[model samples]
Target: MRTASWGRQAGGYAAVVTVAETAGLTWEKDDRPLRGVPGAVRRDHGDLVKELRDLVKRVGVQLGTLTRALEGGFTVDTVHPYGWWRAELAGHPLARAVVRRLIWEIEVTPGQWRPVLPEAEHLPDAPDDALVRLWHPIRSDPGTVRAWRDLLTERRIQQAFREIYLLTPAEEDTRVHSNRFGHLVHHRRMFALFRARGWASGLLGPWDGSDEDEAVRTLAAGAWQVRFFHARADWAGDHELATTGQVRFARRLEGTWREVPLAEVPPLVFSEAMRDVDLFVGVTSIAADPDWTDRGPERAYWELAGFAELTESAEARREALQRILPRLEIANRCSLDGRFVVVRGDLATYKIHIGSADILMEPDNAYLCIVPSRRKSDGQVFLPFEDDRLSLILSKAFLLASDTKITDESILTRIKRGA
Candidate 1:
């Protein structure tokens, strides 16, 4: 099975919140910081592709600058923030191309579809379309994509194009809500992946709304859909924002910004429950639960409830801190245990080893990983834990013996070598 990841949720949230907060701060200083940037870019498939093209071009400009730096051996390392050049280049043009090619293989290519057989070993040779999709981005050029234009349907074309567009920001398998057309329309956010054409691949969100429910009905049938949290019955508004990750909201109070913990939010405001769950579950619960819109004093009541959840005040906050301590401690690390690899990037990383499974025709499909993270900590690197690792699942990592240059193999090798 393809991997699922949530690493982008929190980082995306942080980016937005930081922008909001920074905008607010600049407003206080009488200077506009986000004036030129769109409030937040959102789009459907077509518009998303356009936005992606624009983003890629911009990124290309940056990559050009980094290309200059690399010639001088300016490797991006944790010890030096200056090496952001590499990080900036991580999920760029080439990466985006890989994503699109994979999506075409998983979603559009015909006859290449392989069931998630319980005991199949190694994947069959993908259809010609799948291979073309894989190489398209790497070899993308007017002539290259044009010669194969007839090979992809308009939808697949757009999808693959968007996949390439998405690659730049999809480091560690953190796909974005904006990248997926209708994701933010349903849950606050979501991530998706696909491997072929004429096949179905995408993720389900945590919320259930009319529009989202409708899309899911259309997409879920005869395809793969994994709903992380069941939508609550009462939620009235789409809490797509909740899926952004370890979300915390703050409102200006008496000229000061106060952190509003999720748990402290009025339970009645949530159409569902939010206490005692992992990152995705708790946040998605709040977003899908339908108690936020009742007619009442929004601020006063919320503040009172927030204080109430703090009955033990400091102790309760401390416990809440303890609950998130592991996540916080390893927020940007990746770990490995036996056959599984768990990643904890800005989003979540959860992977399982299929080595023992009989679904592969070769050893290449032995491992399936979600989002992965690479961090330099005291000169030692970490992989996922055997169990007890809780993060969003993103990306799939397959192993190949040395000498393979396929994207998956290259990525794994780079990760291993870096670690």
Candidate 2:
């Protein structure tokens, strides 16, 4: 890190810690006082293990924070009067880890982007006034996106977060309010997830206007914003209910914010905004609850959500499957349908929904129940990115593809019962 940033990071951390004990701030790689401990003191196994585990967890959290910032292009100061992107970084080891691995795109002119490798010489070559933002996949054509995906795959560079194949909803989407994410979500967990993603929201209660909350984030610098709305449902003790509302976009116009039509929102901003909402909903929704299907009225909601149209992440899964299926052992038995990966096994020809990871077998689209496993990958295949649902989909495809060798009684009965 440069000398200037080094001082700022240290002094800032000290002040924040001095002010509030509850403030959620963490130490940097070099700033941890634990580094000053003597080698002999650190030799104690239990103490060292506990401290190392805590440090790792904190650092992981900090890295996740920076990854989201970089992915969302928050580092690009789009509001700069000179229109020069300020992508400078220092102080945080987490920042160094992420920016080093990323391949950026510099906008030399309007609608023209040149891929910028992480080299000092190439970075400085761009003119001072050129706008620089993270090269979002949605900004490019399908061919370009596909090429980049292949490039990353060939390099085997693991991204700190989903990058080239990041879930980007269709550019032409015009939904003013999305009920697609609507359902009961755990109240505390929902807000916590939103906060981690840099969304600012308010409390929702039974009162008039206070009954709804919108988690919002600025996109495309300060020019645009996306709001994910939710309404208070009911709460009892620690269990509270909230239903998702509308996803609306707005623009900063003439010193005041004005609502913008979804079609008019810039493609990159729209994609980024929708992606955040998807993450929030995907993690906190009751539909992701494995037992939600066993509930009463909520069962209908689970069914709808589980069978809902392809999410951006699921869309990524579909593309990955497209590239992976032809190379699999059961290539002939598997085919990528629009939203379902059709896998034919001797016991049953199954259809796995790319969006929800739900399964259906042949003779009828009979739902073949299988939940996502705790282990994301079985370590059998090379995955260019991390996605649990994608892993589940692939695992099921492989298992069913060689169905005659299956020994799991539960799976066998499900196949035989044909439900």
Candidate 3:
């Protein structure tokens, strides 16, 4: 009396369906003359019923194997067997139909494992609301979700690249290749560069021939690339001067430099060259904002003050500060020197002499400091405020402070009362 919903096969295509139990088994085919005849009454019904029972048994075994695979911990290697089984099952009309009716979802965890139920909602550390909203549809039709997950994975990889390296809108648009192998190669190179820079967390690759679905699942589970890009003058020594003599092009891989034909370079290699060129230009340029160079020390000092102001009690503020201060870059760490704050940079340790209207630096005794500019131009003007490294440190400190405690207005109550 147990009913199992199986997929409906019409014109060789299996469509999803629901099932209900009945006292007698009946076989109904759209093209066949037989219509809902009870198995007990018809002689041919015996063979039909036996065939259906066998089909159901086979499907049940496949489903069980898939479930156990998920439970034991699914990985790229582990899923291969399941994937093969799924393919075999899908090739059989009855098995394919049965699988279409099965429900599966990814259990959101530090490990991306498939589960029989939507268990992400029950996990305390999981983003249940967001996962439910985004992953519900994917779970409903697990058999076909690989393509969707692959797209998601590709987007995440591209985002990781963008976070560390600046890309033009046009360059970003052009990065995706129609060729899957070419695209994979591009991601492989990107991951290698990311790892080399010490920006990778967790296992980044076996990218040369990895299954796309496994790659997607792995990235979704907290693996990340670093958020900074570098192009060294020494790294540029590999390329020949351009015919125009206006630019240089090179390729540096595994600490070895080589000249590559610019015109014949692969799309992936060309994209990498673009990143190096952009970084080189960005670092060597100056800024249009005359005041941009002198703004770093002021901004860094204010960021510290704003971070400290989040907690009301002096002791609480000190506790919150302990959590925030370590996020600062070693070079940008400021020390109170009587009335001034000292910031050590690569070239010099700047003693920032603060004033009501203008700030100044000593050793160089310069009114302004040179920093990198964010301006998009063939040529750049460097200024102190434009150095993304300093900005990132300050931003991290602010975020740490904001996340540590609630910023109550009670901290300013005493000052208002005095006024």
Candidate 4:
């Protein structure tokens, strides 16, 4: 074997050489420090050992704290270990490497750090089961998976409601209004069933008749008057049609009906009754809309009916509503009291009476209106309009107050302040 020398002169001058060459070894920049290495290598090795030991201890303590915090349930973010706890762990190199082994995505801000949870499209084979099963491939914690499933369900419900609302006819007198005939006929009958179930009687009002025709007769029996009109062109003797005719309201007063100018009828009655009519119109509109092939409203109706059938008593329904209401963005401004969700509005608050597939609103003693519009994002039956305007503004207000994105920032700030 050829011996390696520390000093080897290629020319006449003295050669300077490294210690590794003298030892018959070649050093590489990427080489790991070995035990018994002397001088600078020894110091580097010692320092590395101490640093690793310290890092291991720190990680152990942090993991223990995390385990304890998650003993109850896994949360996306924990308040106990300080806010941005995940961020803190990622700040250290070794600790970050350790944390990468755990499945977590840090949420930094809007448009940043949002974890892309598995979507329904991710698993082709899974149907309704996809929400819970898709995360298994990633080995997500059970609690996290459960939370994600709930979120998926919530989003689906919201989408269903949005579809229902969007497909509904916004203006009156369209051909679609004809579809409301059946719903209007069945309205009183449904109200009676709602009352029998111990729903808010005040909101539902009183049903004085047994059938649809009887109910209409009873409704028209009071000072309340209703009218219908037909516009027909006069036929000339020779076959030409006359063009001039005026629209009028036929009002029944003191058992005698008379045709009067449209202005004779109170404009308020027409406006209010139109809104009331729209409720039934909206329900019928859902099925008639071409986009409702998914049976969103029908499914929502069945689900509400099922919940009512399963729940035996008023108290049970109240309890169920309490659990379900918090998940709804619209319920934020509404306080639950027994069977009622008291919705607070700027001018006046209304009591939302929850029944099987129906939601009635008592804006005041004079009005006990059924909310005709199903929530377009979720299938929760909701009032479509309030005081002539769409009820969406109220829903938006509730959403603004309960927004999770906004709450996250507030929580992060509080955590940083150690509050």
Best by TM-score: 2
- Which candidate's lDDT is highest? 2
Candidate order by decreasing lDDT:
2, 4, 3, 1
- Identify the runs in model 1 with alpha carbons over 4 angstroms from their true place: 1-57, 60-213, 217-232, 235-283, 286-419
Candidate 2 lDDT, 122-217, residue by residue in tens: 344656676555555555678877876676665544442343323225323634544555667766788898877778998666567877878888
How many pairs collide in each candidate, listed in order? 56, 0, 11, 10
Task: Give lDDT tens digits, candidate 4, residues 196-226.
Answer: 3222222222234311121121112233333
**Residue by residue across 1-419, what tens digits does model 3's lDDT show?**
11345543333223233222111233445434345444443453455446555665665666555433432221111232333434453233434433332333333553464543211122223332312111222123444443433332322211011111223354344443111111101233333443442233232233442222111111111221112222211111222111100122234446554433434333333343333333322222211112332234333433333222111122222222233334334424555443233554333344432211122344544443222223232222111112343233333222222322323344223212322
Query: How far off is residue 123 in model 4, in Å?
Result: 2.2
TM-scores vs. true structure, each candidate: 0.19, 0.70, 0.18, 0.20
- Total clashing pairs in model 4: 10
lDDT scores for all predictions?
0.26, 0.63, 0.30, 0.32
lDDT of 1 by residue, 1-419 (tens): 12111111211221111110011111111222343223343322345435444654664555445433332121111111212312332223333222222222122344342221111123334332332212223224455543343333321221212111212233224321111111111233322211111112244444344222211111111122122222222333343332222212233457554544333332221111111112233223222222343433332332223212111112222222233324434433434433333333221233332121111112233222223342233312122211112222211222221113335664455444433
- In model 3, the runs with Cα more than 4 Å from the true position are 1-159, 163-261, 288-419
